[model samples]
Target: MSNKRRRSIFEIFEEYFENLEKWTERFREALIEKPSWDHRACTMEPLSNIMVTPTEVIVTSDLPYAEENTIHVKPVSEDTIEILAKMKRKIRLDDFGITHYKGGFQTLRCQIRIPVSVDIDKMEVRFKRGIFEIRLPRKQERDI
Candidate 1:
């Protein structure tokens, strides 16, 4: 490939400003738009490549395409629960060489219904990157 002509300073500035404005709009929309909850799964399934330990039930999900910070875990009921996560990143447009960053947010909502009811107040949820670990205490059967 031979060398090409250079772009003017004004052109560069224009493109930068355009992309900047686009990102600003996205952020504003995300903030102002009323959040509509979307359930990704009716129930949470066992992770394909995660470890579950004793004393607590550990569930790790591979969410490479999601943002770790947006992950939210809530106990819907005694045994049933839910997980929600989203991922965002800056990507280049294939058609236009424009550097507008499109959000790659992903929401994985899983409803977990265990064999026994869980105490939502004592539930613990920890998230790092796309991996989420939910530690839940095992329920003991009471004398009838």
Candidate 2:
């Protein structure tokens, strides 16, 4: 009898997963590596950081050239929030001495999801020295 091996179903699945892994890597590099600024929207995504504490969740963004009076924070949901602020002046690549890109941004904007429960109604905001900070009081837990 001639010896021949038939591929099992597990072998087929392994090949499929390998291809999926490669595709995911390509997708991450193509999308995640893009610039933060959106030229068409006239907006720049400011650098931000989030911290969760026992009593509050603190979110901050670096908003250089931003007009404090124009800053607006909107809570889209219990866990999601959006920040938008107008810049005091349009910022262009030329300001940084970059000649290849041609565009200017007039707004600072971003959306983020909070990882913990927070009381948005009592949230406090502050802007100083080009830093925007928001303090949301964490929801109090009750005994059932």
- The predictions' CA RMSDs to the true structure, in order, are 19.9, 4.5
Compose the digit string of candidate 1's lDDT tens values, residues 16-87: 999999999999998956423222322223232323344456556655555666777776776666776654
Can you give the TM-score per candidate against the true fold? 0.45, 0.74
Clashing residue pairs in candidate 2 (N, C-alpha, C atoms within 3 angstroms): none
- Candidate 2: list runs displaced more than 4 Å: 1-31
Count clashing pairs, candidate 2.
Answer: 0
Off by over 4 Å in 1: 1-54, 89-105
Per residue, candidate 2 scores C-alpha lDDT tens digits across 55-92 of 99999999988999999999888789999999999999
lDDT of 2 at 69: 95
lDDT of each: 0.57, 0.92
* CA shift of 121, model 2, Å: 0.7
